[model samples]
Target: MRLNSLVKPLLITGFMLAGTAQAAPDAREVLEASPVDDIVAQYPEMMSRGIQDGLKQSGQVPPMVADSIGFLVSNSFRAADIEQRVVANLEAALTPEQLEEVHGWYQTPVAGKIAEAEIAASAPAAWPEIRSRAEDLNKRYQGTAREKLFDRFDAASRATESAVDTTIAVQLGLGTAMAALSRDSVHHEKMRERLESQRPALRGMVGQQVYDGYLFTYRDISNQEMNLYLDFLESEAGRSFTRVVTNSVQQAVIEPVESIGARLAAFGNFGGE
Candidate 1:
C-alpha cells in the first residue's frame, strides 16, 4: 500500500472488550458481509497518483516507463489478496455474534453513507482541504460536550494504531522493501536502526495525516450522528469487533511485504540474458 497505511485504523478495540462467543463465522463470510471492501477498494487509484508524483519528484525515470511502473505497482500492491486475509483473521479473533453486529452496522443506511464519505475523504486529493477543515472543527467544537466525546474516540483510535507505531511500521516496511533489493547492504538490524533515527519526523507527519483524515471522514455527518456512531463503537460487541478488525488489517498490511520485496529484489533474474 505504499507508505500510506490505507486503512484509517479508527476506534480500535480488541476482543478483550467483547463478550464470549456465539459461534464464530468463517472469515470469508465475515469479510463478504463487512464494509471493509468498500473502505479499501478506493486505495489503488489514490496510491497510483501518489506513486506517479513521487516518481516524477525523483526525476529518474522516463515518463512512459514511470507511468507503466506506477500502473503495475498500484495493481500489484492492491491485488495482493489482502482483504481476504484480513477478514479471515478478524473471524478467527472475534465471536460470530460480534461479527454479526459489526456487519449489521456496515449495512445500515447511515453507515453506508459514512463509508462513502470516508472512501472519498481518504483520497490524497482530500488531504489539503481535510487539514484545513480539521482546524475549524477543533476550534468550532472547543469546550463543548461533543468535543469531549470526539476526543475519546480520537484517543482510542490513536491508542489502537498510534502515529508512532504507524511511522515505525511504515519506515520498516519501506526499509525492508529496499533491503529485498539490496542483498548485501540492507540487513534487517541496520535498517531498523536507520528507521529509528527517522522516527521523530515520521511521527509528526503521521499525526497530521491522521488528524486530517478523522475530520474528513466525519465532515458531512452531524455531531448527533457521530455520537450515535461512537455509542455503537463503545459497546461490548463494537469494541470486540474493532479490536479484531484493527489487528486483521494490520496483519494484512504486512503479509505481502517480504514476498513482494523479494520479487522486486530479483529483477536481475528477468533480464540476465
Candidate 2:
C-alpha cells in the first residue's frame, strides 16, 4: 500500500473507534485541544523508518523493501481515528471543574506558544537545533534552579518512559511483520523478552530524544512563559491534565498497539498453518 492509503486506516486500526461520544470537555476535547496529534503525526513515522533501517542492518530485510513497507505502514498511521478513540476512552476521568481549569490554561498565551514550539519540534528540520540546545541545556541544568527545571520537565512530560514505551511497542509490531516477511525463526515471546531486556540501553536514547525535544520546543520561550507552564504542570490542574492524557492513551493507544502486535503475529501464524 502507498503512504496516502495507509494513514487513515492505520489510525483507525490503531485505535479501533466505535463512534461513541461522551460528555463535553472530555477526552475528546482534551486530545484535540492538546498538541497530541501534532506529536503523533510525526514521531511514529520517524520511528517506523528507523525500525525499517534497523531491520535492514540486521539482514532481516533489504533496504528497498524495508523502506517501501515502512513508509506504507507508518504514513497510514497519521492518527487514523486515534483522537476520537482517545476521546471515547475517557469516562468522566476529568471532572467538569478540572476540565474547565485545564481548558483555561490551554487558552493562555504561554500555552499557545508552548504548543507551537512542541509541534514544531517534531519536524525533521528541527533536529539539529534541538540537539544543540538540549546539549547546552543539559550542561546548564547543574545548579539548583536548573535542576528543578529538569525535574519539573520530567514530571510534566514523563518524556523518557513515554518515549521508550512507545518506541519498543511500535518496534515490536514492525519487527514482527519484518521477521515474517524475511522468514526468520521468530518466536514472539522470545522477541519481546529480548526487547524488554534492552530497556536500560534504550532508556538513554529515548531520554536524549525527549530532552532535545523539550529544549527545541521551548528554545525561544521566555522565562515567564516557561514558568507559567512549569506552574501549571506542577499544579493540581496540571496533574489532572496529565492523568487524563495518560489514561486515554493507555485505553486508546497503548492497549491497541499491543493488539496490533498480536494481530501481526497471528497473521504470521496463520501463514504457517
Top-TM-score structure, candidate number: 2
**Stretch of 10 with least lDDT, candidate 2:** 15-24
Model 1 agreement with the true structure over 31-138: per-residue lDDT tens digits: 665556655565466545655665576564557755764575566556236676676667567776777777777668877777678667766777668767887877
Q: Any idea what lDDT model 1 has?
A: 0.61
lDDT of 2 by residue, 1-273 (tens): 789798989788656544333333655566667787676667456555555666687776678866765665565453645555555544356666777677778877788889888888777666667766777777765463544566578878666777687677766776776577556877777888999999999998787777657655775787667888888887876786776665555444445445555655567767887
lDDT of all predictions: 0.61, 0.67
Clash tally, candidates in order: 2, 4
Q: What TM-score does candidate 1 get on C-alpha atoms?
A: 0.68
Q: What is the clash tally of candidate 2?
A: 4
Q: Give the TM-score of candidate 2.
A: 0.73
| Alpha-carbon runs more than 4 Å astray in model 1 | 1-34, 47-69, 78-80, 124-150, 158-167, 176-186, 268-273
